[model samples]
Target: MIADAAKKLRENIQKVIVGKDEVINLTLVAVLCEGHLLLEDVPGIGKTTLARALAASLGATYRRIQFTPDLLPSDVTGLNWFNQKKQEFVYRPGPVMS
Candidate 1:
């Protein structure tokens, strides 16, 4: 079942991405292994497109955060806030949680 799913995912991604079959395959392998992908390349290399394609193909939630000098860990991990009504700390999920 996983192989079939992976094949379908690859085919779906290929519709938007030309060539780079090896990269796609490795991405599928990484996903199947419960890992993440870190894409670092020069600008306009379809990195965001590839990630969006993979997420779409697998029906997964996708969120992208552009790192800047001022980006903080809390921005990705979220934080806890006090709820006045509830009088308790509420855990607010961040982009990484999605």
Candidate 2:
């Protein structure tokens, strides 16, 4: 079952990614082992593409956070806002929450 699932995932991701079978396999292995993957390379080298493809192949929710000099921690983790009706502070989820 695991092999079948892996094969299906690889095939699905291959539909968008042309090559890099080894990378795809390694990504699958990492995901299966509950590991995180960090793809660092020159710009426009398909890092985001690979991550999106992997997420799609695995039917997982994918969210990307672009860090900039002006980005704040609250932007990623969200903040509390006062609700007028409730008269209480409500935790608003950020992009990372989804």
Candidate 3:
């Protein structure tokens, strides 16, 4: 079942990201192994593209957060808003939660 899902994902991702079959395969392997993949290379080699493609292929929710000097943890974690009707602070699920 997982293999079928992964094949479907790979096919879907190929539509947008051309070539780089090795990267895509490795990404899928990492995902299946329950391990994280470290793709370190020079810029413009489709690192972000590969990530996005894999996310797209899996039919999974995708979120891209840029790490910068002004980026805050709360920004990624989302904020709690008080609901007047409920009279309580609601914890909004962040991108990671998705």
Number of the top candidate by TM-score? Answer: 2
Note the residue pairs that clash in candidate 3: none
Residue range with the least summed lDDT across 10 consecutive positions in model 1: 1-10
Clashing pairs in 2: none
Candidate 3 runs further than 4 Å off:
1-5, 84-86
Residue-by-residue lDDT tens digits, candidate 3, 1-98: 98898898878777777887888788888999999988889989888888887776667777877778998777788889899999999998666666
Residue-level lDDT tens digits of model 1 in 2-88: 778888888999999998888888888888999977888899988898999988888889999888999989899999989999999
Clashes of 3: 0
Best by lDDT: 1
Question: TM-score of model 1 relative to the true fold?
Answer: 0.86
Query: How much does candidate 2 score in TM-score?
Result: 0.88
How many angstroms is residue 78 displaced in model 1 relative to the true structure, after the best TM-score fit? 0.5
- Candidate 2 per-residue lDDT over residues 1-98, each given as its tens digit: 98898899999998988878888888889988999888888998788999999877777888899999999899999999999999999998888897
- For candidate 3, report its TM-score: 0.72
lDDT of prediction 2: 0.88
TM-score per candidate, in order? 0.86, 0.88, 0.72
The per-model lDDT (C-alpha) reads: 0.89, 0.88, 0.82
Model 3 deviation from the true structure expressed as Cα RMSD, one decimal place: 2.6
